[model samples]
Target: MADTPPPAMPTLADLQHWTWLLGRAQQMMIEQGFDAMRARDPVLPAIPGLTDPETLARTRDFWTDSLTLWQRLLIPQAEPVVETPAQARDKRFKDPRWRENPLFDWIRQSYFLFSDQMLAQVEAVQGVDDKQREQMRFAARGFLDAVSPSNFPATNPEVLEKTLETGGQNLLKGLQNMLADLAKGQLTHTDSTAFEVGRNLAMTPGKVVHRTDLYELIQYAPATENVLATPLVIFPPWINRFYILDLTPEKSFIRWAVEQGITVFLVSWRSADASMKDVVWDDYIAAQIEAIELIRAGLDVPAVHTIGYCVAGTTLAATLAILAARGEADTVKSATFFTAQVDFKNAGELLHFVADDQLALLKTLTTDGFLDGRYMASVFNQLRGRDLIWNYVTNNYLLGKDYAPFDLLHWNGDTTNLPATWHLRYLLDLYRDNLLVEPGALSALGVPIDLGRVETPAYIQAGREDHIAPPESVWVMTRHFKGETRFVLAGSGHIAGVVNPPSAGKYQYWRNADSVSSLAEFIAGAVETKGSWWPDWIAWLRDHGAETVAATGPRQPGEGSLPVLDDAPGRYVRAR
Candidate 1:
């Protein structure tokens, strides 16, 4: 009997040729998809004499630079022919081989040139409305990002090297990974099996004090002997799970607040299904009011401080308005909004998906009664395509690398379904029509909602780089509130800015005592402070009536008026 020899390893040239073929096939598929989309919705209107002199000049410049690059390739020089843009912070082209190898360098430079030219052309379209132009720009950027050289195997030096080093095993593993992700119907941004809802991610000690069709209210066990008399009730956005605030003991804002002598109660929203299709925005507001009543009844407190993150914050603002109209504004002694937007005038890139055509498409897709969680997740991922989508695609599919276990990313991937009626009302009323900020423009629970009439002291926090709720959009919220408002700008984007704890001391926040009319004016007067804004927020709460009292542990079934339903990070959070 003779032993068989192992297959020969592929040469670099062979691998490159194979990758080129794969790239071409992928390009053809992408082009076909784009063509179909354009056929349905033309990106730019055919306006007569729309092309200005600047557009012609930009076209000429693109050709000139492209020709110069070709010339550089033909005639080799000692020094590099072109340098990457100084302001360019893309990590994709960080490999040494990208600059060291003339071929890869040219590919990188050429891609950037094309991206700039395409974006410039989109910007130069003059006759289109602002929203249309913005949509065109977004589409062009998405296309450019999709076709980046770094996304392909042949053009990316690191992927090619890994493929060669592993003798094409990486490609086989990558195929397996892609198939697994496709079956799951979502991209694996982190090691999904590394953490669980109650096991590690949302391990804060608590008991589910109350449960409703809409949410489960978890009352965290007090960490300090003496706690604030007024408890803190948090309403996290229903678009995702609530564990984002309770990710880990270290990163858990819920745990940190408990340790800081604050009795915290957080609402874990139910993941909507077909049965919940009849749920409306008013139901959510009613659920919030119900949670507040439950907290007050169980703890026997007259009022509580409240916090809302993202979309829930918008609802909370409405809740405040409803309370004010009913002469019950004092129920929420103080309100803190975390990266929440009340105005959508400059709502950023997410606005591109809220137009009539896109909404109509969404309506058709949601015939199943609820919008699939994956749909919203895909939209968010597209907002930062390079970081969220392509980065994972390159690692999981191209390089065959598994992502690290990150609690934040784990929480991010745990998406929740949105009821069709509630989601549509939110998009149309709040985002499209910008009615939330306008006094008495919206109503819930049969009360005319007027944000200006709510005089509860507010601590509004905005992420300086937030895309979902632009800081400018958030800043506009300060103007709507007639109460004593303190606007704090935190460093980093939405999730990072809000989940930041004092112990980590990673990013900085800014505060200004002086009044300001606009985001720009606020920034000009604001003073920078190091570390997390949690402590400052705590101080604000204390100043605005968060008095300390003897702390208590999680309540047992017979211990309080509200029965203990379950342990911390309850079943609602565990829902798929």
Candidate 2:
């Protein structure tokens, strides 16, 4: 596979080149759409004779409703569905200047009408798959969203109000924010001061005991006097920092586990740079094994309970399969998969972007040996433009507001560059081909990776509304594990579903004691439990952790062979 080598780093020239290429592709697609529309019948069907009573009655009712609507509009009444759930939350529109103003309301209604007509036209396009059609619809919506009257200073009343209040200082700050982001390749969104790693967030108090070119292992200091006989080590996706599991003392799952009388260790993958372009999937696999060994040797335990979240879990599942085939599966006593998908058959709408043309473009762009983190983030932002993108546009440019202090959003904005070789391998072997879930169809580290060979029992949790890794895809992971498996249908989405603490008592979890099956049957047989699924997970942990020992806290950093490199949230995690 020939690759387009990215320059040492993205230069202005490189950015402009790729931007133009993308624009060209967009233009071609637009031309194809216009031609398709022009080819369609522009003539209307013959009108029904008014002699028909049903047609005459419908015409009369339409005139009556029009008169009623006219009277209501005169009274300044807004239709209930005029503003969708998503649009209703826009504070600028909430102002009387937008709603009470009849002209603005009329414009809003007209815009919605145009949007509906364009979407209908996109749907009527023939000889296309759902994925292709969805892309067209998404593009149409994006164009409409970009031109929203609220996004402009002249049309947005809120921006005018802010200008009046601050004497244009708000606009100046907004320009500052925009320039700062542009300098960073336009990846930033959240306010950097909102939360600092190892200060207010990711401060669960752990030490980096092992460091490698690919990853670092952090051994968290135990909170309880007596800890579980076996240690619990976590593997988080390298796409972002692992601090999400240790965000805050209140919401940190790692903290909760330590407090539950269990020793905890976290695997933190290093943020790569241009120099690390040669890194590959095998490197990450080796890193996982190295982490397990370091934790096992440091804690003086023969085996450890393992948990993998998102893509990290997918790696773990494959790792376990290889280990089981090698008769070394004892390294992991039990397993847990959180919002992870091993199968891509139903990975969700994101798959639409993986088609041939898109993949070809991605390949060209990533030939630089590493895919830029900002580039990846931009693509993901398009998947949920309203929440991930347009919302920020409104707040940053329209409202001229600094990013609100949000830990989750902050972490989301902090993305990592991925090695090209490894990323392409993943996209092809897993997402595109879906070879991971198939028995005897894939291999890793020269060993055949058959998920059915994995005898390690697992507990899997799926979010109710996860679009990236759909719940159905997560549930499909249970089919390969040979041991007992418990599937939990948790309320909420990918991140919130996994991070929900019982203390908050917000979302509920549904548990089905039966074996692995379709998501529908599982939900039908499941029993709903209010609060987080952490307790049930803890119970399962206790069951796996049969023998207890007198609570000697976790091994200190630099204990024995694995030396403590630095304090928790090491330099790798703190990297940009």
Candidate 3:
């Protein structure tokens, strides 16, 4: 029977089986997710009209538009042409004509402007939905929960009974006003530029130092005298603002390290301009290399410790690898990455955006200009849109919840533009190509990023609750480094994890070669810790610090009382 024609592969029965199985599986997943959420918060039952008829059509339309854009305009443009030679494809990104694309530029501009308009429209709508409003409604419901009702007068039986008689009419009015305030504050921007004046807090009093030239070094003594000997230089991502690390006097990591006697210098990257648009990834690494040299020259230190945070972390690893390949590893003592991804093999949901098609579209958009901050923010917002983005929508717009103004949120909303050139290069070379992980994949600024060549002792940190950089994906650092390395899983999301103050209550789970059998096992046994991760890190640095030298004279920049900026966390970042 001709071996029954070898039987048809992927037969009709197989196809039908797969179709039914897939349908059932999808249904199960959806039910499971809903069940989990409802179980955790009984208030979820209030969403009985989740699919209200009035909003149903609008919601469907929104998804349809979104899916269409995703598949056609967005997806095709962002996808990477991996099968082709990366070097040749990379060259296409260099053409002057590519930067002039209108669609690319329009979307970048429209993303931010449109986002602003949409948010405003939603805010104008008073009665959106009731049940959805409670999603973000934070208040004390009982005495035993996170918050106590006794703290509020209404919790008392006498007051509660009286309030009930009035049908809570007075309470409702106050709630309306409070909710309005939250809605407005959610997208509020403030001008704090005045705060960028030269003022340094002191036990005594001293002239403040302000170093402006990108090449100039700011010299200040960290309060501690017995600090770590490894010359520590910090590289902060320039995406938002520089002061995230030095947020407040009490929470500043720079201040903390200084008090611990660790020599620390942080890079305050200039907000890039049109001129900087011509600058590529190579220039960035080159700048870092130059900074290292300058720091070494001034300190006369044999080697230095390098710390990179978020995007800066990946930048640091890339620079170290390039330097190492050039036989300059001796200049580097150690390296630490805070929530940075060097291994892109599993870039998580983020990869969905930078996938070949979306990136190609973004490339077209950014051809003539920088990736508008609004566009970038929108992409990130979409990642957890239902929670971070939409939950706020329900509370602020629908329920009129009021949020007290917070410096952190204020800074977060203050967006920064990205140079179109640098943004494209980052996407093409790092995100989509996965060059940093692949040997010789990316040759940035004429130097290849050889992770195996990065011989500096490394400490890598990933956050357990980080949606931006998940633990499983970020832990890839364990396999990439060629030198002595330790990987840590921190407690919070990307921003909270880093800014975690000693007062912050959370414990991180992690595994090290010396302590645990494997990263998975360690994570499984992880326990909660009280207080910030900063103290533990300070202790780590102390153990690594070289013997303290006689307190050296303050290394002021010039004779005329070295010019001081308003303060360490000054105006450059405080700009609205």
RMSD after CA superposition, every candidate: 8.5, 13.4, 21.0
Across residues 1-576, which tens digit of lDDT does each residue of candidate 3 receive? 355556557754465456556655665675566667778986754342342333333444443333333333333454322222532343212333322443332232233233433433343344655422321121111111212222233322333443577676545754665455466443322223422322322111122244443323344465654445556778888786666666556656666666666666666666655556676777667777877876676666677788888888888888988888888898987787888998776666666666567877887766556666766766666565544454443334323345554556555665666788888778777777787888788787777778888778887788888878777767877678788777777777888888876754556544444545455876777655565767666556555555665335433222233355544444454343
lDDT of 1 by residue, 1-576 (tens): 788999999765565455556655665664465456658877644333233446545645765576555545444463345554641567888888877777887788788888878887787766799888888988998898899888899889999999999998888888899999899899889988899887888888888878888889888887788888888899999999998898888998888888888888899999999999999999999999999988888888889899999999999999999999898998899999999988888989999889899899899978978999988999999999988999888888999997799988888888899999889988999889999877778889899888889799999999998988989989888998898899999999999988898889799999989977788988998999998999999999999775677764333222677777788888988888
| lDDT, model 1, position 103 | 81
* Off by more than 4 A, model 2: 1-97, 164-169, 553-561
Report the lDDT tens digits of candidate 2 across residue range 493-535: 9889999988999989998877645889988888999999999
The models' CA-based lDDT, in order, is 0.85, 0.77, 0.59
Model 3: ten consecutive residues of lowest lDDT: 138-147
Candidate 1 Cα deviation (angstroms), residue 477:
0.5
TM-score, predicted candidate 2 vs. hidden true structure: 0.83
Checking candidate 1 for backbone clashes, the offending pairs are: none
Which residue pairs collide in model 2, if any?
4-367, 5-368, 6-368, 226-551, 558-564
List the candidates ranked by TM-score, beginning with the highest: 1, 2, 3
Question: If ranked by lDDT, best first, what sequence of candidates would result?
Answer: 1, 2, 3
Candidate 3: C-alpha RMSD after superposition: 21.0
TM-scores of the candidates in the order shown: 0.89, 0.83, 0.63
